[model samples]
Target: MVHRKHNRVDGKGRIVIPVKIRQAMGIEPGSMIEFDYMARRHQLVIRAVTETDQRAHNRET
Candidate 1:
C-alpha cells in the first residue's frame, strides 16, 4: 500500500516532510534527504539516509 501525507510548498518552494514520515523513516533533525526523479514517468522518489546508506557513501568517498 502507498502511504501518503499532504504538505504544500511555500513561496520559496519548500515542502515539509510530515512528522509521521520522518519518524517512520527514522529521520532525525539534520538528517539528509535524497531524491530521484523519473522524467519519463514524472515521479519523484524520496528516501531518508540510513546508516547503511551512510556507510556505502563513505566508502565511495
Candidate 2:
C-alpha cells in the first residue's frame, strides 16, 4: 500500500515521517532506510531496506 504525507524539513534538514505512513511501510525505530535523490525529476525517494532486501543485496555484491 502506498501512502503519502506532507512534511517540512527542519532547519537541520530532518523531516518527520508521519506515524501512519511509518506503520504502513513497516518502518520502526532502528530500521534502515535508503534515500535516493532524483536530480532530473527533482524528487526524493525514501525506501526501507528490510532484512530480505539486505540479503538479496549482499548476494548481488
Candidate 3:
C-alpha cells in the first residue's frame, strides 16, 4: 500500500502530484493524460492507465 500526500490545485489551476506517487504511477514528463466526466454522477476523472499500459507492464514483467 503506497500512501501519498494530496495537493490541491493552486489559483493558477496547477496541481502537483507528489514525486513518490508520480514515480509509482509511472507518470513521466510530457506524458499526456486524458480526463472524463461521468454522465451519471457528473464527476470528473483523470483516466487510469489502460490496456496500453498493460502492454507496457507486460514488457516490464
lDDT of 3 by residue, 1-61 (tens): 7554768999999988677766766777765566798999998666446668768877999
lDDT of 1: 0.85
In what order do the candidates fall by lDDT, top score first? 2, 1, 3
For candidate 1, list the clashing residue pairs, or say none.
Answer: none
Model 2 lDDT tens row, 1-61:
7677788999999999899988888899999899999999999898989999999989999
Report lDDT (CA) for all predictions.
Answer: 0.85, 0.91, 0.72
| Model 2 regions lying over 4 Å from their true place | 56-61
Ten consecutive residues with minimal summed lDDT in candidate 1?
1-10
Give me candidate 2's TM-score against the actual structure.
0.80
Report clash pairs, candidate 2.
none
lDDT of 1 by residue, 1-54 (tens): 355987788999889887777788878998888999999999989898887888
Cα shift from native, residue 31, model 3 (Å) = 1.1
Ten residues in sequence with the least summed lDDT for candidate 2 = 1-10
Off by over 4 Å in 1: none
Each candidate structure's TM-score, on Cα atoms with residue i matched to residue i, is 0.80, 0.80, 0.53
lDDT of 2 at 35: 97
